[model samples]
Target: MISKNTIDQVFETARVEEVLGDFVQLKKSGSNYKGLSPFTDERSPSFMVSPVKQIWKDFSSGKGGNVVAFLMEHEHFTYPEAIKYLAKKYNIEIEETEQSSEQKQQEDERESMYLVSEFASKYFQNTLLKTEQGKAIGLSYFRERGFTDETIKKFQLGYCLDEWDAFTSEALRKGYKLEFLEKTGLSIVKGEKQFDRFKGRVMFPIHSMSGRVLGFGGRILTNDKKAAKYLNSPESEIYHKSKVLYGIFYAKQAIAKEDNCYLVEGYTDVIQMHQSGIENVVSSSGTALTSEQIRLISRLTKNITVLFDGDAAGMRASIRGIDLILEQGMNVKVCVFPDGEDPDSFARKNSQADLQEYLLENAKDFIEFKASLLFEDAKNDPVKRANLIQDMVSSISKIPNQIQQEVYIQECSRIMDISENVLFSTLSQILAREGKTSGVQPKKAPAMEVVRSPEAVKTKVDELFELERKIISLLMLYGTAEEEFEDMVLKENDKGELVMEPEIQKAKVFEKIFLDLQEDEVAFTNERFRELYSRIISLLNEEGEVNIEKFINGLDPELSSEVTTLLMEEEQYRLHEWERMNIMVKTKETTIARLVGETILALRRFLISQKIDDLSRKIKESSEEDTKESMEDIMDYLSLKKVLSNKLNRVM
Candidate 1:
């Protein structure tokens, strides 16, 4: 267990902006920063980060919290894992209490797999440096590729011996489980025999965005034509190639700093680009680009430049990814290297500046690039050219922003030598097709047909609204108070006058609400509202101040999001900003304690009045001997009404 003091230190030292900026691109807006919501698929910027409050709120999804909360929400990290990540990032020393074997055994299986993968990475890397076979084969292969020793070490390059079961034996001797080895795809098992999966190949460890080793990618060296060029770890608990981008661990900072990412297609391409001084480069690892991977890059930067080989097939295959990027509201540009050249070969042939200039001059927006590349064959054919125009409009319609989509349509029409109205009509058809395909519609609830006195229902709703308003006011004002109300007695002096001693007291509305709900046995109908009310009361008791900021900061992301949505919603009666600035807003001169007491009394009176009205209407409508029962109910209602009326009169 981490000490409470250490947790406090971690929270205090970690800055919200600095931590979140690593993942989400933020731009200054007023006293806060705004970016596209990472929690949802949205085009416009709705996620907000406040430096003054040290918190973030996703206006779209409603997730808000401190830095640790952001990590937990965005990265799916647990509390302890988030803390450790922050501790590592901030270079803080962590002191932990020793855990018993049983407690250690209770750790999550995924986390355990991650730990085992990390251990295997270190073992393979150590073998490369310490063992003769690893040094001769792995080190030699890397050196032959012109990889400096520093680069080799930086990427943790390693090798596995050709001898069967060498890595398996070493891991077992070190007490690592063979089951986990197979689970992480590090060891292949046939019947009862287990052997290292990457034996006789050079190692390339694949990492999660946070730099944890999730799996590995190995390249074979022998000239056997039957042997595959590269083999990556199969899907495991921690590694999903579709959702993971290679080199994100190394490229994140550079991506953030440059505000752009250069995406290529191989591990060596990534290594060579970084080696040649372009640090913000990542690879797709030869898989089809996925929206998840695009989102991963989108979180760090809004601009992406895809570098592909000049082969026609390769360019065609990669054009599909551009539509995905456009759908994300990312600004995408494409640069095709010369024939027979990839990013690795191109970077190696030129200096960083020359290569950067070459890319900058050659890169074109998706629309222009797509048209120029595809229009050559369709120039003389009207039907094929019309089909090409439709295809471009379909891609344009995927862009969420109306303005961006319109701009692309105009560009498409101009480039294709077609009428703008023709492209616009195509876009409308595409949208209609998408709407039908998605079946997007607002859900309607079946109406309840309860017969009741309209006045009674209205009165009940009004009373409930008043009670809620009072509770909201009190919570906003004195939720942090620590004491109960003080009592006072009044005595008649002479004639019909009464004199009372004034008592200034602190009120505990939170406690009162809890106890009152328990006493009246009234159940809240809305589960979220009930949970939020209960949590607010608990938080008030835990901290002297309810600190709206801190309370929201510590809540679970889903709940926090709901609470933020509630608090930030505009009420029907709101003071205008100008009125507030001019101090024209009404002020209750009476103490907040008294206001709370009066508010509760008013709610009780209101509810009693509603009951009286209901009974009166029933008496007017009913015609039975049960009229006697109705009469009794009316009497009871009047009696309570009289008592409430007296209380209300006395308070006024």
Candidate 2:
């Protein structure tokens, strides 16, 4: 086990937004950072990381915590592993006795593999930037491709030497396990011998969204006829070729910001476009684009523009990705470069403005682009033209949205010079055929339960439960905030009669809540709330304020999860930012004092009502002797009720 001192230091030093930004593309939102949830498929951003609070909340998936929790949940790090990862990241020295075995690959195979891949990426990069062989080969290749020194460093581009075992031997000397070396496919192991997988090639490290190196795509600098020009890391535990995009780690923010994604076919294409200031772009990693790959972009934007080579073979090879994009209901546009040109060449030859203009001008809807490509030689031939029309409709039919399908059908009709009805009939035929083969009918939505007011259906226990929840939320959110509270005091006036009056007093939120609840002798009804209530109170009293981060870190997973959930409930409403639209919306932060007082007033009123009801029932069940005492109790309770209503009026 790691020392508590180390864990505490990690938590205090690790910035939530900074740490999460590596894995999730985060943009500033007022005081917090917001991004799309990496856990689920979504178009809008629902994940929030608060740097001040030092916690994260993914409202979409409802999984959140401090920095370590994010690593544990996303990276699948064990508790000790998470701490060590942080320690390494922050350059904190872990006590040797606790972390002696941490370097072994056998302890956690997946994480060890990740560490090795990361180390390999750095090794290759060092060789490229520092070594004579790598500088002559890899640096020359990137520079010739119009990549600047800054661009090279930003992408962490590197090169591995041609000599076999160079990378493997260095990794072994550094104490990286050979098992992870082979598992990540960075090295080719044969019994007692090991060789570098990417030797003699310019390296393009394929990164996970969080910026961990999953694998590499190395381009051969020499024209060796016996070797594949482009070699990719073999499918490994961390790197799945079909699921990774070359520049996604860098392009994610721009994609979300521009609300458009430009999909390319290779690493150089992505790097060149990004160098040309086209930041909202990524590569399919030189493979046929998959739905999984498309879904990754869909999380950022529902609009994709695929840049294909101008050659007929290149166009034909990439034609199917459009259908897959359409199937995901994304608005896809195809931009084929001029003859003898691709994104890499065009980006190199033209200025940024010219490239941007060319892309904007050439981009066509899927139907128009498909028609132009498929009808290249078939336009004058009636039989082939009709077949090509069928192909066009087939792609359109893949669109899941009926409205988008109809729009594309209209375009197909216009471009193919066919009747709209004819295209619609053909699309219907394709969809109907697919539906029949699909064989899964959509299930109807389950009936929604009718909601009634609490007055009509709630028991006293339920009401108390809700009130208790509010108390917890208030304490958790604003316990240390100082505010002026109106304490309603019942006292004897000059007329010697007991009368209720308001006493204005300033108090910390926790003190106000603590005194009121203690005054009323109110106990929490729910077990979790009861525990949290006492714990929060104790922390406030003992520490003079709640250390939310420390308190949450000390909690068990269940309670910590509960605290995160409660804290993030308001984030859903905050995302709307209705005040920007002049809606005059009030935030809880502005009215916390009133909020605390009202919650307590409501709790007091409910308890008083319950007491009056209990007394009335007893009066009915008992004799005249009991009725006298019950009537006086009811009168006093009514007076108390009147005082509560007045207090509520002031608080409201």
How many clashing residue pairs, candidate 1? Answer: 1
Alpha carbon lDDT of each predicted model: 0.76, 0.84
Compose the digit string of candidate 2's lDDT tens values, residues 1-652: 5667777788888777877888899988888888888777788889888877778888977888888888776755557778888888889877533444645444468779889988988999999999999898889988988789999999999999999889999999999988889988988988878888888999999987656888999888787999999999999878898998999879876786677999988999999999999998999887889989988887778999999887988788778888888888899898989899999999999999999999899999887887778787897899999999999888877877777777777777788888877777777677788872222222346699988987898545577878888999999998999999877678878987667688899999999999888877888878888899899999888987778788888887668878887787777766766677877766799989788978988898889999999999999898998899899999989887877787677331
Q: Lowest summed lDDT over 10 consecutive residues: which window, candidate 2?
A: 436-445
Query: What is the model-wide C-alpha lDDT for candidate 2?
Result: 0.84
lDDT of 1 at 189: 92
> What is the number of residue pairs that collide in model 2?
1
